[model samples]
Target chain A: MKVRHSRILRTAGDMLLPLLLLFSLFLLLRGHDLPGGGFIAGLVASAALALYIFSRDMRSARQVLGTDPRSLLGVGLIIAILSGVPGLLAGDAFLTSEWYTVPLPGGREFTLGTPIIFDIGVYLVVIGAVMTIVLSLAEAEERPWKR
Target chain B: MSLAVILPILIPLSAGALSLALWRSHLAQRLLGVFGTGALLLAALWLLQRVWLDGIQVMYMGNWPAPFGIVLVADLLGAIMVLLAAITAFAVALYSLATLGAEHERFGYYPLLHMLLAGVCGAFLTGDIFNLYVWFEVMLVASFALLILGGERAQMEGAIKYVTLNLISSALFLSAIGLLYGLTGTLNMADLALKLQDTGEAEGLVTTIGLMFMIAFGIKAAAFPLFFWLPASYHTPPVAVSALFAGLLTKVGVYALFRVFTLIFTQDTAFTHELLLWLAAFTMLSGVLGAAAQFEFRRILSFHIVSQIGYMLLGLALYTPLALVGGVFYLMHHIIVKANLFLISGLVYRLRGSFQLKELGGLYRERPGLALLFLIPALSLAGLPPLSGFFAKFILVRAGLEAERYGVVAVALLVSLLTLYSMVKIWNEVFWKAAPEQGAAAVAPTNNALLYAPAIVLAALTVAIGIGAEPVYRLAEQAAAQLLDPQAYIAAVLGEAS
Candidate 1:
């Protein structure tokens, strides 16, 4: 679909981008304990980016991304692999989840672990892979000969 | 020890990611390509040694127990296949340095190749059936990308067919996994083998699921009736890519067949294995006959891949220790020889500038070394003596006789003769005949070590396997014994809980 520029959409997309990204982060953080996870959160974030592309132009959307989607993929995968290494270092199998307890205010405790890091990695990978495909397909559509 | 189990998968995967991260640097990507595959070869060698000395190696992902979490198991067969994949990947990575266009390299060839290697290794190492399906998709995606990397018209056409058929196969595989899980409540293969043994009332459902896996894996293996996609697409890629696919891809499918039939689907050998036997015979006959008609260098080699797959399945079909040994031996032998053949075909294209036998001639007169390199694989592929293929065929044929499967044995010999005919045709057209009079001034052969080194090493490996067949045969024999008796595998995966 050729999305013609609409001022209202452009304005709304600019306003909604931050909200959507925050919500995605919420989903990623809640992934280990709840139904939300890296995959869904990444999809939601990419969907927000797709909206931004439809309202603005490809150049602006890419400017906002600020780096190649391919690099995001590489970084995400490396992060994921690194997260798995702690398991190996702990004398366990690869990808074994290790937990750490943090002291919170009022004598409370918060649990943290490698799974979150792994989830963040997956989050980046999903977004990067999806955007790479979508951006390329959009660019392909923009060719003058394609018309 | 558990860490060692995953190194083969992890190394290539990280290398792929690293190569992608260094996208702007060609020097880095090239270095990553060689170093990554070389590291994988070393890791595979170490894993094979560990598995040989220590027996089956099993590691549960995330420290989950067997039947509940994903498990990586490196039996001897799995280790052997991993080593073969590393061998092929390393060789092709070297070959690609010479032949791959700069455009393709810039467009992420090395990264994709490494990912493909990771996928192949994962498929070899994973012990869970669902995980196996995931690995297959990993392979399919990377291969599909590699196949159409250049985005040529013919490649697009080939990729469509390849993807469509393979996607169907994957669907079948997933559905079968679903049905098997529904019936038995487990996706762990070792656990499934145990659960399946007790599913007395659900025998028919189990067998149905088994057939589903067979058809699914059969398409991937390029078995009879579902093999059209292989020849349609295998030749469209660059020669290094083709060599990699020829050596590794379909063999993974064959490895899956060996794993499933020998481990999980052994309950009704009369029904399932019997079907495999007939299908294997037909796969052999049809693939050889198909090669007899093709004159294109890669196309001919592609068909031979299908035919060779038949011999492997025949070993599985006969379902005896010796036959399984032969099958394992053939897997090693064929990966080396077939890949070398495709690599040699690339060298031929470089020298003569065509894949069509009709357009090519007189390589023997100009570059006799190339002729000799081609002959080693071509003759061995036809199952000529004192080469790896000869020993492989000898064992399989003997196994067929001992099992009293005379009809398939006869077909096997007949197909061997026909394979020789096709090889001779290539020899005559590409090497023996006078260069078509137009290019009377022979093209000066470019001396590129990257091109010939891989083929020479692989050819030497083939000869070594033949001359030192005893040790290799013993390895296969032990792998076959492990395959025949699932107790060790089960114990290794499930620990004392089983």
Candidate 2:
């Protein structure tokens, strides 16, 4: 027999969502200069997504994802590969990073580079790969709902 | 500036990524498989030509300096191996297009094939030891998935054994790399060559690490006492996949052994090489005897693979200029013939509806064309005169005689005879015997030109390489010279070797 979880635990998992998501975003953006980056952020975000799925159903979880994990996998991989194109264009070796300085509204300089794009691509790939695994395992089981 | 060196990896990689993103479209994936492998073949050929002309083509990823960054280096041996691997991939890709059905396509067969190619290309091109390990893992992952794609019980069983054993090998490889890095403080092969030679201390530690590497690559190469995983699993997959594995997978291990022993771990030749010599003797004897006992079509071929690896290892064990050339030549020869044999076996299965030797019959009467095709590779595989294997075994035996290792040379010749006996057995049972009373299963796509195309093409290649040995011999000589003398390779990568 399947042991269903209590309503309170489901509610708590749902209520904890915003804070977990914001922390994951923070981890993603702060990764360039600090200890965090795309990989860790992806794991955290995937954890949050898994929690939501645990509290709800796979169909709703699919709706929340907005796209299949496989498409995300392809997109991430292409982005990572394409990010190297700029390096190739600059007559450098493949995957060589180039930096640019952008002016913010406060007259401060912000740095941008292909590494950021690469990191984001890595992030998406990790999430997509993990989600693909988790969802496949999850969806292999049969659950009942009204037709 | 050899950007061409990187294309072999990039072509398959991009194809896999593209195929992954377009998972819903079977047509797109199939086209990607075809175009990607075709482009890869062209790129590999270009890379081989570039290496032939320029000597050693080296490309540092992201322009990082050597000894610090990962470099893709294609010398004569590396370039030729990559070219042959691409050749096999192209043929097997064609075979898969016809063999892997709609269900397999839905399961991402095309992407996985490209992924395996990427790992193989990376393994060939990498100039770093640690990076070689990474490529091995990449191959392991893709191949494991491909091994059990249909989730058949036998496939799962075979895959379990393959994965478990390969994982242990990976752990040993990783630990050996870690120990070597700690000893020499470098991961680059050229730099390691210099550092390993120059170090006065840690002689015993170096030998121990060398043995560790041998064990790791030994398992991959399926050498004696560690070759069980190969015969246990190779026949379990589809024939196209098996052909791909037979053509390139074990050869990668043999290549690694040749590379590492020739370049990095030549510290104590007497002890290390003597050990390899005995291993080669046992490997050949057991492999051939195993083949003799097996009644299944692919299983016998699988056992023969182990036996053939022993020949390549014998060349390496001899450790002379002629012997190394023989090893390299044997690698090129065996890959083409073995893959063709496996592919032909698939056609036989399609016609006869079984892989059992007892059930398969009358192919010579039914389809003489297929019999003729089989005869070429089979004769060549058994070391007949004027074929590629004859030249390969001849050079190896001559090298052994020159080196005065008569015992192993005698064993090698004996194994060659046994190999012939097994080939005759297959011929008599599968092609010449009367059809069983139960009758054979009818085949699909009756014309099936696609099925015969690769086998015929590969059979022709075997004949061409046999008839025209001078140019291929020259390539093998150049490759062996580079392997025998590590200074040029080191200088090419690390700027004159200090």
TM-score of each: 0.97, 0.96
Q: Each candidate's lDDT (Cα)?
A: 0.92, 0.89
The docking category that best describes candidate 1 is: medium
Per-residue CA lDDT of model 2 for B352-465, tens digit only, reads 779999988888998999999999999899899898999999999999999999999999999999999999999999999988889667555355777899999999999988
Checking candidate 1 for backbone clashes, the offending pairs are none
Best by the TM-score measure: 1
**Per-residue CA lDDT of candidate 1, range B213-235, in tens?**
99999999999999999999999
Worst 10 residues of 2 chain A by lDDT: A138-147
True contacts kept of each: 0.75, 0.67
